[model samples]
Target: MLMNSNYKVAFFDVDGTLADNELPRELGIYGRIPESAKRALSKLKEAGIEPVIASGRNYEKIADFAELLGVDSVISSNGTYVTFQGEPVANHYLSTELVKEMVEQFQTKQTDFLLETPEEILEYAADELLPENILQFLCHCPKEDLPSLDTEKLIAEKVAPTALNIHYKHVSKASGVEEILQKMGISSDQALAFGDEENDFAMFEKVGFPIAMGNGNDELKAKASYVTDTVKNHGIWKACLELELFEEE
Candidate 1:
C-alpha cells in the first residue's frame, strides 16, 4: 500500500507504460490499452485521483486513447504539446527553418523519416506534407548516423537503433507535468507517475509516486519508489490494486 495521501494525480507514459509502443515507423501493432488499465482508471477516479498522459508521441497520436480513457490532460511529444481539459496549455514547436533543413538533410542522406504535425505523423517527402503546426520529427537510421544529424536547434534522442526522436531543445515530460500541476493548483510532489524509459526520467524525478514497469530499463527502474509488472500484464491495474487508495470515510 502507498504510504501517503498526497498523491492526487497520476502521470502515465503512453508507450510501454500505458499502451504498447507503436510509433516511429509503426513497427509494432497499434494495440489497445489494456482493459485492466481502464478499470484501474475508474477505481483511481473513485479514490479522487486524476490521470494525465505523458508520451513521446504527439497530440494526434495519443488523442484517440486519451478520448477513450476519458483523460483530460496530455503531455505529448515528450513535452512539445501540453493540454488540460482538452485545451492547449503548451504547444512547443521547432523552427520552421530548422524543420525544412532537417527534411533536406534526411532526403539528401536518403533516409526515411516521419514529421509529426498536430494532426498526424507523415513521411517527410517534401514541403507539401509539412503542417502549419509542426511538433516533432523522427528519423530512421543507424546509430552511427545520429551524430551527424544533431544541429544547434534540433537534437536527437535514440528510441531504437534505427529510430531517433528529434525535437527542440529543453523539452521534456517534466516540463509538461509542471504546466498542468501549476494550472491545477498543486505541486509536483502531489502526483504519481508511471513510465518505462529513460525519457520518463524527468517526470519520475518530479512526481511523488514513481512506478516503473517490470520491463522498464534498469536506470528508470532503479529510481522508482515501486516497480510494477510489465504493461502487457496489466501493469497499471496491478499497481493500482497494490496502492490501496480507498477513500477516507
Candidate 2:
C-alpha cells in the first residue's frame, strides 16, 4: 500500500552527508556532524519525518551514527543490509561465485581491500590505503592489529559474505537500495536520498528526489535534482530546509 505525499522518508549518506569522511587519505579525516547539521536533523525529527542513515558502511559500524542522529533505522553496506531497532529487516549476501570472483579479481589487480561478513571485516592486501584510524573507527582495530583470514579455508567452510567492497568496481549502491525497498514493502518513489560519489549513481535512478552535495563528483551533480552546498558547509540542511522538509522553527 503506497501512502500519499504526507508520508515521507529521508535517506542520508554517511561519509559525506552526516559524518565527515572518517577515512584517511589526502581527503584527510572528515569529523563528526557539525553543530548546525545536528540541529537540522533534530528539527527534521520534530517535524515527524523519518530520518534514515543510509551508507556503505557495515550494519554494526553505522549503527552508532544512527544512534548519534537518534535515527533507529539504517540501510548499511550500500544497501546489502538493513536493520531497524536492532531487528534485521533485510540481509543480502553476495553470491558465493561472485565473492570468489571478486577476490580473484582484487588479487590480480593488486588492489587493497577488505571483505565483510555479518560478523567480521577481513583485511587483504591491506596497506596505507586502508588506514588504521578508519579501521579503528569502523571495526575497532588498528590496521596493524587486523588478523588475516584464509579465504580458501572460508570457502571450504562454506562461509557466506554479507557484502563485498573493493577499492574500485562492483555494482552500484542503487542495487542495494532497490532490494531494500522491495523488501520493506515500499517503492523508490516514496523516498529521498542524499549522496556524493560515483558509487551513488544507481540509487539516484530509483529515488523520488536525488540530492547531490556540492562536494559530490561531477557526474553525480549533473544527475541530481539539485546541487546543494558542500557537506562541510551544511549543504544538506540548507537544501532540506529549502525543500520544506522542516517548517523553520
Candidate 3:
C-alpha cells in the first residue's frame, strides 16, 4: 500500500511500531529501528513533517525517547495530556472524586493498577501480583524505576491540577493521538499513523492511512491500509521506500 507523502503530520507509537516491542533488551521482532529506517524518518523531518509520539507512558519517560528521535512534541498517557517542545499543551487528570471511587472499586476487585503523572509512573502493587509476561513486554525501564505505591497514600496526596493521567481502564493510545492533532491544529486526515496493538485501534480509525507492523495483532492487520515487514527487518524503512517517502536527498 502507498501513502500520500503530502501529509503534514505523522504520528507513531513507540512499542511494536517505531521501536522494538522487546525494549530494554531490544530483541523483539521489530527491535530497534534500523539505520535505514532512521534515515527515512530523518527525511520526513527534513521535509517539515511534524512528527509526534503518541504513547501510553508518562511525559518524562516519553520525552527521553523523543529526544533521541529528535521529536519535540508528544501525546502521552493516552489522550490525557500533550506536550509541545518542552512545554505542556494540554493536560488532564482523573477527577479526585473519580479517583476515589475507582480506587475503592479496584481495591474491592483486587485489580492491579497504575497511575501516570507527567513526571513518573506509579504502580499499585498488591503483593507483586503483576504478571511477569506483562512486565517482560514493558521492559523499557529499569526494575528500580517501577516504584510500588500505597494506594491509600496516593489518594491522600493532593494531586496537582496539571497532572496528565489517572487511568482506570486500560490506557487509550487513541486519545493520545487525538490530543496531538488537537494541539497541532490539524486533523487525523492530515496524518499517517503506525501502530500494532488493540490500544492503537481507536487511533487507526481516525487517520487517513494506518500502517500496521507485520508482527502486529491480526485485527490491526485487517484494518490497516498497509502492513510493513517485521520491525527488525527495517519494516519502517522498507515501507517508506516502497511508499516513496524516503527519497534520497
Superposed model 2: Cα runs more than 4 Å off: 1-7, 21-31, 94-114, 123-172
Which residue runs does candidate 1 get wrong by more than 4 Å? 20-32, 124-130, 143-152, 247-249
1-249 per-residue lDDT for model 3 (tens digits): 455667777778777778775556545323365666566667778876777788766577777767767788888766566777667877666555555454555566554555556666566554653321121011223323323333443222112232222343323556666666777787777788888877688889878888898989999999998898977677777776777765755
- TM-score head-to-head 1 vs 3, winner: 1
The prediction achieving the highest TM-score against the true structure is 1
- The C-alpha local distance difference test score for the whole of candidate 2 amounts to 0.61
Error of 1 at 177 (Å): 1.5
lDDT, candidates in the order shown: 0.79, 0.61, 0.64
**Residue pairs in candidate 1 whose N, alpha carbon or C atoms collide under 3 angstroms:** none
Question: Which pairs in model 3 have colliding backbones?
Answer: 30-231, 30-232, 78-176, 79-175, 79-176
lDDT of candidate 1 over 92-178, digit per residue (tens): 887777777777777777777787877788775464756767788787777565435456565677767678888876778898898
Best by lDDT: 1
Report RMSD for candidate 1: 3.6
Which portions of model 3 show Cα errors greater than 4 Å? 1-3, 22-31, 104-114, 123-171
